[model samples]
Target: MSLEHSGGENADSDLYRIRHSLAHVMAQAVLDMRPGSTLGFGPPIADGFYYDFVLSEALNEDDFPEIERRMRRILKQGQRFYREELGADEALARIDEMGEPYKREYAQELLSREDLDGLSFYRNGSFLDMCEGPHVDTTRDIPRDAFKLRSVAGAYWRGDSDNVMMTRIYAWAFDTREALDAHVTAFELAQERDHKKLGRELDIFHLDELVGRGLPLWLPNGAVLREELEKLAKELEFRAGYERVATPHLARADLYRKSGHLPYYADDMFPMMELREAGDDGEAVKEAYVLRPMNCPHHHSIFAARPRSYRELPLRLAEYGHVYRFEESGAVSGLLRVRGMCMNDAHIYCTEEQIRSEFKGVMQMYAEAYAAFGLSDYRVRLSRWDPEDGKRREKYVDNPEAWEYCEGIVAEVLDDMEVDYVDGPGEAAFYGPKIDILCRTVTGREEQLGTVQLDFAQPGRLGLVYVGADGAEHTPYCIHRAPLSTHERMAAFLIEHFGGAFPTWLAPVQVRVITVSDQFDEYGHAVVDRLRRRFVRAEIAARSDTVSKKIREGTTRKIPNLLIIGEREQADGTVTLRRYGIRRQQTLPLDEFEAWIAEQIASRALP
Candidate 1:
């Protein structure tokens, strides 16, 4: 699903060229197998390539083998690729002769463009495709065994659900069979660590159509995990001198316009809420309010609530604000992409001279947070501004000096801290440059875990100022950071990172006391009560099942520690402890075991 290239390489490599050519060959084979099929766009992706087509008969995975065989035959024919350039009018005529209505429409659109000179077409065998020329010389360049048809799914014409749906055929191509096999193994491992499946199996979260698409209802266990993460964030922010503040979930529309997010982020934001009031002339005036898509605008207002002085420089306001975004139905996954999320958001108002130290402090906060969660594999991205071309200038604020100054400050701070990072141009926010933390999941997926943005535009636009030491008013720079990301995304990342087996500090139920038989049930309750008294999440499983069965059930829940109470343990006033993912069992006194578990939770151990 990720189309981003890997290994610090661009999309123009030889593998990319091979994949692109394979897509055209696959389309040709599909047309030969199903004669009346119509083709849409086919692009080379990160792993492989996929093509969209409309067929007279429904196609499924069962049809892949036959289609692949036909593709092999075409490959064996050793057809040479030839490129042809033609005027748009001539290209449309050729497409019409081939009876490809969709291709004809595409060619006509390109012809309507005044800037374009002509169209480029590639031909191999009896098939011709409109494309840029970067294909292999002949069909023999494709390895017969290096390509495979993956699967079939329904996709909209251009990813818009309102458009006509087409059957999309996915395929994988690689330089060699060994590389393909390794990728296959990695993909299978990723499937095993998929958070959606683990969320259900672990009773962490669920999505119901009755509630609505992309809205997830957190079960009790999941809520506990969310709260634990929030608690950790609050503790860190508090120690770093951040003041906690609350904000409304809905705000007036003009607020976003002032922050410069209205027209830019409108599509991703939920629809506006309009309220009407009667006027004196019998006319109604409407005021629009939108669900908060971000917390920065509101924080800006808070900074401008009163006049600030130089003594109050570096004012940090923090919040665990809940935000709503109108993600398209197709883009929403279980917890990774959802309609509602709680952001561990905060903004710092600091003098220009304090930007470096403030930014470094935020990086230190990230280090502490990742250490708490035992997250180690992550990279930093310093997202800078793109060259201000006509349209690109409109995309960013028109302050070249401010952009350069802010970018220089971030780079200096990163260099001072000796942090490893990569440059990402054109990935900054509309008003500022940002440092994005990218964490690599166990599944070989990189996720944007947190961000720290330096904004020199919003404070000026929102009229935020403070008196300098010289008794003159000056605009303050803003630093927006979230070391811990939204709870939904963080949970998904942790679930996959730990394979649904959370650490002691973050686990929903740290201890489960199991009774071996009916007679020892009393001892099991006593242990649960004692652990609960110490604020440990504990439960007693007193079901009348075999001890092995109870152990298996507890293991499935992934509880960090399991205490088994049998006749001998009851007589000895002790318990047998079984740790998850370990084969050894150690017997200890009840009080000693309780103290050890409490210490693990208090220290936030990674056990």
Candidate 2:
């Protein structure tokens, strides 16, 4: 249900084997039921496993009960998994004889693409599949009550849109039934707190097809969330000695080329636009431009714009820059993955000698911001390049010395800070190593919310230099940090984190003043105006509705505070206050209430 699988642990664990073996068992059961169903791929996922099939009959959830029963029956037989190795041609022949055309085709493609000694197949009972697996020794090893079929959906064969769509059966598997039940409960809760659903119900943001996919238009309320987050980031950055700067949304293609993003990250970028203009010599000059995928290049250009001295070391430049990425349509989901985003990005140009303190300062800022947001369930990951990887040169900067130097600096700082972090080999950026802040969502899925990367190559490549105390120019190490990530991702996290009931300071409407009746309308307006003057984001609900209805509406809208004004409240200089998710209601003097709410807002109190 809520299984947390690290990349390394999940690959070879016994749980993985159970899930893998279960996939084959499920496949056999499906084939037994349908009689003519052909299989594609069946691989274990984080929580469970799924198999793709070209079914002769259309299948739905209604048919799952029978399929699951058959799976249990097969599991009770205690079938032993036997592994066999055969030549590629023999494997293809066997697959063809089994009448699995997709498997035969995949085997052929693999044989052509890879240099292999032979192909391996695993046979459990009468079911045979082409898989390189370390499956459970026997069907008895899989818990009978710990797995269940979850849902059915269409998935393209081989994940290619041009290929035929196959029916995919998803299932959940765990070591124990209790784990499965816990995961199911968490999953149900996650569905209720889904950001996409809350975003619509709360009127925060909208994704319109006319505007294109993965591009969200923030409604008024959603814009308020974004602005509040920006305000918070600016305040923190200012105190941290970060200078705010504005960068254009698009820059010349040459800028990205110099930053090494073009050759390495071109696929994720929009196509370049070429422009031609007449030069002073009457010759046509051609230039290419692209939407900025990141703010680092622009910041680098700023650092290179003028000569710098060591006194200006750690020249921190920050921006809430708008960036665009060419995310695939299928990959984009709600605000978590989008084509357009506003990044809380910054670059610190510091000398090699100052890299430790500068990097530590960024981490401190991240900790402080997380504390303010009440985010404690997160882990730091030290992502590094795998020197042993065969294509390390192609995947990372091809300078081992620079890689060692920068990675050592990062590791030393993290060690000195005594931060607990996991090593993520082969997860580094193309240019350098990075520290990723991975936050676990309510559903138990891990999401990367923030990152800080150390770059030793980009500055030299971009011609960024500062005069050293020795009076000679030297390259400054560039530290790229984004504690709050992007506006979209952060808002999505917060939406689910708080279940749309944001704290007072972050709520779009902090308070709603509702009149008990027409007689209290004037008083409600006065209270709202007073609150508004204090910048409390207060509004008045003076419609001819009942007091209960108005309060219910305000509660449903997730207003953190609701003020009810009646004859008594108007007669005295007092107001009745209702707080979201709180049962008690208190009536206090208007001035006293204002002071308390102001303190809450000022402190950014979390509920």
Candidate 3:
């Protein structure tokens, strides 16, 4: 993980220096405890710092307290941190004298590969290591009560699996004890709301070794969540003048090459499959196909299938297209990162003058969908290309003029809509610039949940054109958008956002009818039938358990509404209702309860 400050301080701030200095101090303490241990890399990370070491002995969680105590003693020594600069040969000699093989190897590699003029080393008391100097002047700058060693794990040297495994010691650091405590509490809450754990408990989705990693099998309940989301997307897209379309999951390799995704995105796509077919002359012909990693190319093919006129300018094609990607084994995690996903994807083919209006409509649709989901903690980012990058031709389409014009158009739209967005230089898509919607997860990390990319290269490459009113062929601009993202990612987000207790409409099991005793089983089934006829996802809990036990079970499953079918309620054609996360209960006529629930679901009311 990238380093992040616990107090929201940047790397050049005082808190960062303190954290960096603490890492060195911790290294000093560890070296004192294990005399022959050699250090690798010690860097400050999110919330704290960690030091990697090739230890002479094994370490475990049991040793954290003693190591922390030694660290505190070193902090009290008030050792001054001194920096020294040396040439390449001098640095290598110093590393050799220090008897650290990893440091010497890394120094040599840096000198040979990066061609650095020199190297810098820092020293505190008798301990010295090769590092750039931004450390605190003295060890006393670290607060004793604000930091604690978190855990020890094995990490490959320099994060390369081919290298030797080293012991990594992690610690949590903050500017104050209160901030550290608050972080601890929030971390615990995040663990409690972790999707993997809740997914199994709620029976939402599952991962099996046989089915393959990163491919989730959505259980019955999980399918409900997905279908409901797709229903919402279809309704919104239909009202916005979008025409739904379907495409195959795989396509010919030449298709991607034509769309400029082959050389740039080949590594992330699955291996190509070759087939032999009979040619027109009865000879064997070879063909190749691969699983598509995106839906835009296929949509472009649809747009180019027939000749078009200027009247069909802003043709919007939407699809829940299933795409496959070859994610690294280590990068695949639950539903967040997956190999197979059904993207809520679409492409808008519009003229140059119509680009702004079409793009603004997409943004407005996103706002409407987010408002319906009650999602407010998100920011819009204008990810632009960098012209000064050394490998600009390889990283981006080297069209400076098109890049400038498209980026200006997107910025103008955001300005006209009064949307607050931050500029993200060097983060644009390879084809062109894009607008990214980043939402903050419950764990305090921002994730890119949706995107709208302006493409100026693909349509021309794919030969997509329309006849203008002047009777000339003109290239149209394509806007690739996904407001709801993929079902897997959105479901994961909603699972965490609502803590698995979704609102009435989105809940997997909307209502459960519990019979007070086996005698009330008939009434429970009748009530469930009535609710199901009204299109509510209702079930009958007709077990021979007590009323209180049945109610507890329904609540545990996170059923939003529970209807009690007892003798008194059955006799009067009424039902006692209990809502999840609420303490009060009420008795109402069965017809009245049905009407109230239908309205609640129709309005998509939140708890």
Candidate 4:
């Protein structure tokens, strides 16, 4: 890690050495494929490497293999990587003479840096590249076993849109062929597990280009999941002493101004809608209404709605608030980031003394919620104000001591809980510090699935206060948290996590009661109705299809249980139970089978 190792030894890891060597080989391959191609920096990444290139022509998928061939040819020659130092002007002249404009520009920029040493170039075969090298001495060391050209993607030069958009070629290398195959297989499984693909296949949601890119239309199945989550949240919050409240999707422009969201978070907000009153006088009215980007502001309105006393200091108001934010078209993805979405959002206004207990309550609630879904092993990012910066007084409230004091309190709480957490400096919300729970997906991608933010600024900004025991006005602390962040995002994450084979309770279709013949179709219906009466998700496949074919279809849909009834079983008042993703089937009486299925569903058993 860059955190632990300021500089690294080249021989420490052969995987890294070969991967770094692969980047150089890839760049040489690009130059060979495209004559006027100018090279940018290509460094080894976490998995592999990607080289950014300024190409004379756009290279499509057809160009990847030729580039790979050129790379292999260079590898076969076993050319020595000869590195040499050159003056700023000399380096620019050499790159410019080779018609490598990107290299020349990079050289000029590095030349302006006071800390930069001269410049270094490494040559292999007929290709020479400008780079800082800790690379292998020769191309012979570059492994040929399990390397592959992944994809071609676009990236802005230095990630600046105003600059040239370069083509980036991604490639990966593994230490062994077996490891590479495992990675490839996992990637394929992830493709099937991809929410967007599975969402459409299972009829969950859809994104229409005409309706706008990031706005998703939830289908019936998706809506069923959303309502189920809301049912859970409402029940949980009710038992936890939360009062449900409703908020408008769009609020007056002045509301945001008071909340301090207008100017700072304006980029994330949608374009404001203008309203007007019409009359014969034709008076022009101009008032703005913006789609709320967050539910925190609206919940604050509820807090300030009525006069309060110290007894009500720990007021918990919750809302299933739908918000809208305009994400750049390029950044718009699936349910992860969307234009229209809802949150299981809530705010707790509590006294300074109640802060610790309230936070602990939230942590306990989060534990219970995740336990129900069997989601564990997550890292917590605790964002705190940076004390190193002397300007903390101006940035935070005048109570500099209070900020540090609260930081210590939160740290103590996390320590007492014995949770794994890391502190992030200056990553807090503009108002106060927060903690984001991050977890990696099945395919090794990190996701910020849920968050809990602590705030002390918004209440004061809105002039909210409660009468204290001392008969003085006081601001209450706010803890904004969401356990099941959003129906869209949670469904997406769980789909991938379970690989579409959901536990019985959450499955859209939990059981499929199939029968041996059309003669037994009536018995199958009877079985489904019996299960459904117990609140178990059950279905009957009464089509004129073979039993084996019906079983195949049921398994494909990932149904957890399949009860097959034949003439003998129907006469005996018994059923053969076939569980999905398992090796064996079992025979049980109807009552016993129902009881077992109920237990599995209630426990949310992993099949």
Can you write out model 2's per-residue Cα lDDT over 538-604, one digit (the tens) per residue? Answer: 9998789988899889999989999888989999979999999897999999999999999999999
What's the CA error at residue 485 for candidate 1, in Å? Answer: 1.1
Candidate 3 at residue 128, lDDT? 97
- Encode model 3's per-residue lDDT on 109-217: one tens digit a residue: 8889877988999999988989875888888888888898888989999777889999999888887888889978888898777778788999999999999989999
Better of 1 and 3 by lDDT: 3
TM-score-based ranking, best first?
4, 3, 2, 1
For each of the candidates, give the backbone clash count.
Answer: 0, 0, 0, 0
Candidate 4: Cα lDDT at 378: 76
Local accuracy by lDDT, each model: 0.87, 0.89, 0.89, 0.80
The residue-by-residue lDDT of candidate 1 on 265-341, one tens digit each, is 89999988878888888756488899999999999899899999999979999999999999988788888888889
Using all chains and alpha carbons, the TM-scores for the candidates as numbered come to 0.83, 0.85, 0.87, 0.89
Question: In candidate 2, which residue ranges exceed 4 Å CA deviation?
Answer: 1-21, 33-47, 51-63, 72-125, 128-146, 152-168, 174-182, 277-285, 442-444
RMSD of each: 4.8, 4.9, 4.3, 3.7
Q: Which ten residues in a row have the lowest lDDT in candidate 3?
A: 1-10
